[model samples]
Target: MISEKERNVFEGMAIPQILLSYNNGKIKIELVSDSFCNMTEIDRDSIQNNVAELVHPDDLASLSVCFLKFVEEHSNLDVMFRVLDKKRNCYILIHGTGLWQLMEDGTEMILFYFDDTRRIQNSIRHIYSCLKEKDPKAEYNDAVTGLPNLKYMRRFADEKLNSFGACITQQVLIYIGVKSMRSYNDRYGYDKGDALMLLIAKTIKEEFPSSFCGRAVEDHFVIMDEFYGYENVINKINSINQKIKKNAYGITEGIRAGAYVVNPEIKAMNAFDHVRQALKDIGKDMNVICRFYSDERDGELLTERHIIESFEEAMEKKMIRVFYHPIICTKTLKIYAIEALARWIDPLRGMISPGEFIPVLSRYHLLYKLDLYMVEQVCREFEVRKKSGLPLIPVTVNISAQDFDYVDVPEKLRKILEKYGIDSDNIIVEITEQDIAKGTDSFKKQLCSIRENGYRLWIDDFGSGYSSLNVLGQYDIDRIKFDMAFLRHIDDNNGKNRRIMKAIVNMCRELEIHTLAEGVETESQLEFLQEIECELAQGFYFSYPKPIEETKKC
Candidate 1:
């Protein structure tokens, strides 16, 4: 047993302390400090000699092992367990450290100091809060919006998903991205941009109420909550956008959201990926507000992943081949220029459609590589045709807006042409009208440099977007390729499209910008192009895009 002085010393300490005595194989509680009783809300009379009763039931086995080890090794006890708070009917995590003394009467005395883990955690949180206040860009929270960020969302998602197996309630993971946010930031200032983000974050929290909300990235927010139904979630998103528009100081761009219902097959992070995929399905159309994940979209996402993974290998093996679709001079019925198109012939999947892979690459900004590769291949074909004495027509290779960001387009094309000992006239640069409509200074400079370097520029997919007339007036384009939509809807609306097509061709002719009508399939379409005096035409009515060798024959 502990002597009177030692017992008084242990009890007088400010920290919660307990004294126990061991004799033979049994344990006995000798004394308890006032602090220990106050912390645990257990009276000394209530505990009596049964101190083990105060330990949590779940912690009893671990506590026994800790005690046994301490006694056997004559080591200081340092262990963590839960102490039952009888008054509160709860358990508190406690870190207990003790030193054992061999008593004079063949008894062992143990003195323990207990620290409440909750108190320590609270102190740590206080320090962290001070630090976060000093530095806005703290971990786990977005500096701009003061909301939990992607890292925090990931951890929260894991915890929620771990508990989902036992619960029947289905949760929805939502990803929302503000459309035209960059333009908004450019028009307003970055401070206003940050304010916009904060407003959206606060709005999302208010709208979802019970959901876990976070900033996924710039102008994008994520939310997870119990999914009542699609209508409920969509209405909430609409409400969020309406609130944002009203409060955002004349912000015009609305938020687009994608939702995924949580399922057992996917992990936590993948839920975000699925919702992002659903958002991508909405594309650039500002009218769409919300989209939900579907199995078809998931399959497309898988295909996109496969395409991204296999792109480098495909390029190495030259599986990404250039097929030339011949554009014909309508008057002479002869090939005027061949538009170089990428055709990925996977050994396993055979031919993959451009519709499947082009947008995927464009989304990921991988189109620059494919575009440059197409240019190089076209130059090589020029070389082959020269060596074989086959007729070489100028080849128009499509360039995406992303290509200019990746490389100096004019310089890159100059080097590729020089590499093949080919002239710039042998290759024409085709940029979509929509891309030209972006009209970034750098993009405009690149286009000017291309033309100044003797490479012709053709505006592809003209009249596809709203900025067709504006594009023609601003840029010095060599040719205008009408978008297929006009031809597809030619006879609709009592020949309204036919009249528009005729007027556009007439305008192009007057501007000295040569015109081409693509997707000309039937005899009527060809006759319409001929009647409108369209300078060039290309579509299935002539020939499909064929390999370089087959194109030479045409």
Candidate 2:
């Protein structure tokens, strides 16, 4: 039992604390601090002997579990729960840390340090004050669209989920991401952007009248509604998109949605996360406007998360290695150039496919790190080849559209070359036709700057997108690598694909822009490329992408 001096010291402390004695699975609050009474505005008489009555009913099970776990393991207890504040007529979030000991009287005593600092933080106070100044409902409503904000939506969903036992109902969370909103804002203005957002908000509200809607963030909206089958929800989303397009003041951008069926077993916020994961999986594919979350997608999301989290460590530990795929001369069967591909061999997960991690990194705008690392590794490989008396050939490193946004590609590449004492001529910069289609002035300037710094420019995956011909006319590129799709479908349409491929190669040859046909896996393919006078060919016919050490032997 706590002595009179110990009890006095605990009661006199400023930090909110509670002393509880557990006997026969029943807990009795033995003592409470003045700070606890002041913070919660609860009288000592109400909770001093009955602490369970003060805890939120919804959180009681979790609190009981925490105590039970502590009792079994004799471990420090940490839990977050809501406590009733009688004066405010609301519950305050509390983080409690408790230590337990066996008292001399055979009772288990637990001293819990309660922290409600989140309620009194300056940031929370400032937000509340600012919102109150704006309007009476400012805390719950978004200022621009007059729709419920994210906080309000979360609370609404939580309340609905919390009452699931009383009224069990199937529900779904939908995340709508506004496409091309940034470009729209740039084209118009912020006022016009706000107007566009208001139009979308109004459309969603009208389409799903009974649903709880909110503006999650800039250009993102969320909805929680009764599950009314997948087809019904998809059709409603289509209607919303159509209505917004018609009324959006010449804004052609549409919304992409991801939906998740709400599981009462999960927290309200996690439902939002799952829905966003579905949306992220949709990516930039125009064909997929709506995607539903599934167990497989969730597993993929977890894997992507692991890849992202492990990237920096992978780089530091030299797990990301550069592999070279030789681009061969179609006529002489000699190596003309080699494409540097990044291969990640995680020690724990083993070989992680580029198909898996590359897209994840690209989506997260982390390709710049990988691209830069590849450049440095290529320079180091050049040094290695020189030392080994091996032939030096141009190494092509791919730069993603996202890379230019994160770093000055030309400047960084120049430095990496200088650091390894390698000439820029030995390195080639490759970009996709789809990247050129973006036509951003900054990207265009970056491309020019790259060539000006003495690195050869090549366009990879030509003919994969519609802008291939247009890109050739606009940019002064040294080489155009035909996309593997063209070769993959060469026999399609009764020789139409072969005719198109031949014409493109011949046109490039006439224009003095060198041409390379990739994915040439057969002698027939190679003979066709040689017939068209294509300058180079690269595929398994010559060599698969191999480790640097293995490539030296080739």
Candidate 3:
């Protein structure tokens, strides 16, 4: 019942509209816009008879509710439904908004229009695309870089190692570390970081197409393959580095690598730890680029892990025993004192060396336990000797820098000595020059407390790193033990070490601090130390580190 002017206004307006006459649940389309009929491809006559015929069967129920709501409220209406365009034989979603109006004859009709739903459908599809599965086979590939993730690579490595048989020993797994990546990420941005990672991944794929490459963790990539040796691995890593530099990410970045040779006898997870060990060995020195695993180092790492895993039980079972290496007095040519060293005598794994377990203890922050254990063993041994009427000598127990972090060193030692009814002077403490070089207040205070309590202190492995005569003026130390490394290279470059050792020993003598030389295996080395006036010495030439029972025989 729209008037002429209103109908003209509706026709001129650019919108798809339809006018319906509603009476008692029956709907009759009275008027339709030309645009609406064109869009739906249905003529006005067909729609005027019954608009319900064009509505999709599934959307009819919802559309009926919308109409009922509009009649009850007598207000605006908005609803979404699908329509079947019979001409095209396709369903088109539509959003309709309208208002209910009363005519002059008291009849009610709904005036409405619809906009296409294609845009909304497109948006929904876009959201779903973001969540599409990256790795359908569950290889756990990273969505951004398209490289296998850590879990997938670990599984792959375990399977490869387990099935490779005798050929496993020849296989090598290499890990590449991007230096200063965290600072780079912070300075530039995450987008650039991700870009660099993608570039690195692409370059790796091109360089080692046959090898299995994966992201082990942030800024670390793992590549597994059979290479000829360390030389071949070095060449390949260098090539990859060159390629990365010349490519897009123009930042000055460097890469270092460590490799592990497959050990068929051990688990793959343990083998991975070996590669990490190599990196730890040389990663700090920028001069080295790549290092390969050695069987000796592998065994040492395994032994260290075994010690850590079993240390507590070993201590309770008395498996960790104290070994003594005699320090000989140069003038008397007799045992003056013994250096107390720890040995893990595992009943199942046999003997584990101090060299193997010491670093592990430091890494796990458990060196304090070992240090305290060593001191207690020394105290008990001295007490037993005194009770048995056996001769007792001062025992030098080495303490680690990490020990200071864990306890009051002076008080702990005092208690242990008191518990065994021994004087502090009976047990001397040896600390490394490197540890002292840190010049920590705690270290200085502990050393002063020990010396004040009448216990002697020795500087072990002196001249090893950053050693100087000025150090003698800084602390009250009793003896300086020359490192074995100095003796190993004594003949290097025509007696360069000989002159250095002589000068060092002379300097210590002038300072009135006693000097000891270790690793004097050959008679020539002994003669040189004796000639140089080293006050005390310990090495295989005197005696190997032996158990308490073996000391009497020596």
Candidate 4:
């Protein structure tokens, strides 16, 4: 087994690295991991004599001085020089210079390397920079602000695209547009509008700190860089909105963004499609950030646009169907509540998942009608079961973020329930985590009102959205369908991501509200939760989603 100190550098280097120790004139390469040996074409036992043996003849003195300074001064001296390989061929080199103690005896030595060929090409026949130095005149430019234009997005994107060629590391791209800038120009005078644009750019610069704030278009600014991470960017984006409200005056700060991390290894031009997908993800919301532009996001945007034209056919022609997933009483394993999952029975696709069309329904504001129709269908199902001497079990229906605040949702619910002779108590309303996280106070109040009207309010996908604390506490909710992400984490014992999930469940339990874990796929995971004394749960281990009749068979 490799010693601890030696193993650290070799563990994740899928590339190459070496650890060497020297005493007097005697030198030894203590260890070289698989990557390093394969890369260097030299066996460790063969290179154990003089440390200077591997250095190119011309670089030996410079390498020696680099080593001496590291030993004497105890500082980093990152020097890139050429070194000869096993075949005596000189090649690009890199050294990670530091004074490393050997055996804790205070016998320190210089630590450096042979090849540092990973970064940008040497600009001056020396060190490499990550971003290639492109001719300045050739990059993208905005005609309005004289900044790098959208055309240049591809240029800068080239450097940042991930190993997958996807834009990822730069946590995510933030495409910003100051909406109504033209309106400001028209109403408040062009000078005031221009002044506002400059202020907008300045504010983004000051606000984001390290972000590349450039005017990418006439009324838009793009902040490019590793400006944010996947985890915190959503909340940070919200903070920017609040900040604009506090500091921005007549600007109104209507910024819309299409954020994407180019897939590492993906070509630059293709990454632009990801940005466009993000724009569509934000979907007519002028102030929202942290959205993806691909069908990966809410596929419903396109589905909804298509649904708008098809809503008449969908409703009048009887195309929508209700697929029920049993929300079981975990203790008894009895189906206590049935979640009415909306399904689209397109004339062609037969049955389509909610992932296929719900987004489209939400986008076109047709969700109110669709949700009401489901409510009516479910209420009628409840009534039919009651009249036939079957149990009048509760039915849960998912609601849209847009539908929650629409003035007519309550009225429609009341009319549908009353017409079906089903009490409001039989109907439960569930909204997704992302919905409540992104919703306004009115949205929260809208949900609170429905629950107040004797309908239960549930938060679904508990771990997958912002506002975990709120999803468990702040937002008014009756039950939290603990996103299965919590259970999925039990297999990872490193305490990395699972801790966030553990906190959510514990917080929800402490609140004295019901917590239901969704997507329970593994017995060990379920055993893990049971060990934690969690009571409520749902998933394939319990039940999979199916049509009402299909569920009856199961």
Best-performing candidate as measured by TM-score: 3
Error of 3 at 429 (Å): 1.4
Candidate 4 deviant stretches above 4 angstroms: 1-305, 386-391, 438-441, 468-476, 493-506
What is the C-alpha local distance difference test score of candidate 4?
0.63
Across 202-229, the per-residue lDDT of candidate 2 in tens digits comes to 8999999988788997789988788879
lDDT of 1 by residue, 225-250 (tens): 88899999999999999999999965
User: Model 3: what TM-score?
Assistant: 0.65
lDDT of 3 by residue, 271-322 (tens): 7887887877884687788887788886776677787889999888889999
Q: Candidate 4: minimum summed lDDT over ten consecutive residues — where?
A: 123-132
Clashes of each: 0, 0, 0, 30
Candidate with maximal lDDT = 2
Give the lowest summed-lDDT range of ten residues in model 3. 183-192
Candidate 3 ranges beyond 4 A from true positions? 1-141, 148-176, 209-216, 222-234, 256-282, 285-298, 485-506, 521-533
TM-score of each: 0.60, 0.61, 0.65, 0.47
The predicted structure with the larger TM-score, 2 or 4, is 2
Candidate 1 regions exceeding 4 Å error are 1-163, 167-228, 232-258, 275-290, 386-389, 552-554
lDDT of 4 by residue, 95-153 (tens): 44444645555565544444444342243223212222444553454423455666666
Candidate 2 Cα errors over 4 Å, as ranges: 1-156, 165-170, 174-228, 235-258, 276-291, 401-406, 437-449, 452-454, 473-475
What is the alpha-carbon lDDT for the whole of candidate 2? 0.84
